[model samples]
Target: MIKKYLSATLVGLSLLAASSSSSAKVIDFEDINFSPSGGFSGQDLTQRYGLNFTGGRYGFSTLTATSYSGWGAHSGNNYAWGDGYNMGIEISGNNITLNSFWVRGALMADDVGSITVRAFKGSKAVASKEFSYTETYHLETFNFAGIDRILITSRGSGPVLLDDIDVGFASPVPEPASYAMLLGGLGLLMLAARRRKSS
Candidate 1:
């Protein structure tokens, strides 16, 4: 009975450690407070979302009924908008796998266009893809792994809208001391099992 209990405890510990290490997050841009005019710029979202936005021309805005006639937000009332051709998003602490995101062309008249997404680790570009969109929002999927930064550039006539960025954080590596503790627990379990068998 003691051996069985120890084995279960060890398994539970392993699972707990794993569960704490990795997680998936979706940035919907809804939590940001927009101005009374329904749009705002120069707000720092790093503290709230762990994403540092470079290229000073990016901001958040609402997709109202009157404005952005054909386009809509992927999830909520708000979405990220960039007037500049290029925008950069830097992950705060660790590298992440950028899974997918929702995007659309911003202009009502010139809404048909393409955008290029590039993932980088440090200064090295790892992955890149171009996606085309109409006035309606569409999901763009990617398997950009081990990337610390992502650059988005518009290839069309106008700006772009973005929302629902899905990303997975890399699992935190277990410390050496954690491995030692696990080994010690296994040793204790083996010793207990031997004693029971001999007795």
Candidate 2:
């Protein structure tokens, strides 16, 4: 009986470690960008509120409620002013969790607009948030189970930027009891497998 139990325990530990190892890790990925083709010009004297992504291009671009003067198709199309031109990304993971990430944003007027953010896990809405324009340089954190997608939104006139996005398991991650149970289950399964093999 002791031999069976020991074999079971080891198997469980191995499985627990394997699953734990696969959790999403934090890394620097392309957060947002504002393409230069749209009057960015990359000029020194150009608009200071330029949207530069991690890759320096316009994939997953960002916009704010605050509009810029002499920008976009017309003056009204400026990045701010709640013209509704914004960008976002989709992120999710398996057996993993997500916490708050950082964002860069500011308001030209006191009437900063509203912010809308949505998160998903395999086509399911896992989380969402909307903040008033009063917040600046907001570092929003979120925790989720088996995360799989991320969504960000903004409205009105503000200049918002996002970068250095980090994703990982929750603090005090891999709860002790959860690990214990996982390891125990694996150990029992292994013992059964070995017994079947011997037979």
Give the number of the best model, judged by TM-score: 1
Give candidate 2's whole-model lDDT.
Answer: 0.47
Q: Write down the worst ten-residue block by lDDT for model 1.
A: 59-68
Question: Which regions of candidate 2 are displaced past 4 Å?
Answer: 1-18, 21-24, 28-59, 62-87, 92-96, 106-111, 133-135, 169-199
Model 1: residue 58 alpha-carbon error in angstroms: 7.5
TM-score of 2: 0.47
Residue pairs clashing, model 1: none
TM-score of 1: 0.73
Residue 146 CA displacement from its true place in model 2, Å: 1.5
Q: Cα lDDT for residue 173, model 2?
A: 47
**Model 1, 140-197: lDDT tens per residue?**
9998988888877666656567788898887767777877787787778778878999
Stretches of candidate 1 off by over 4 Å are 1-13, 38-47, 56-71, 84-93, 185-199
Of candidate 2, the 10-residue stretch with the lowest lDDT total is 43-52
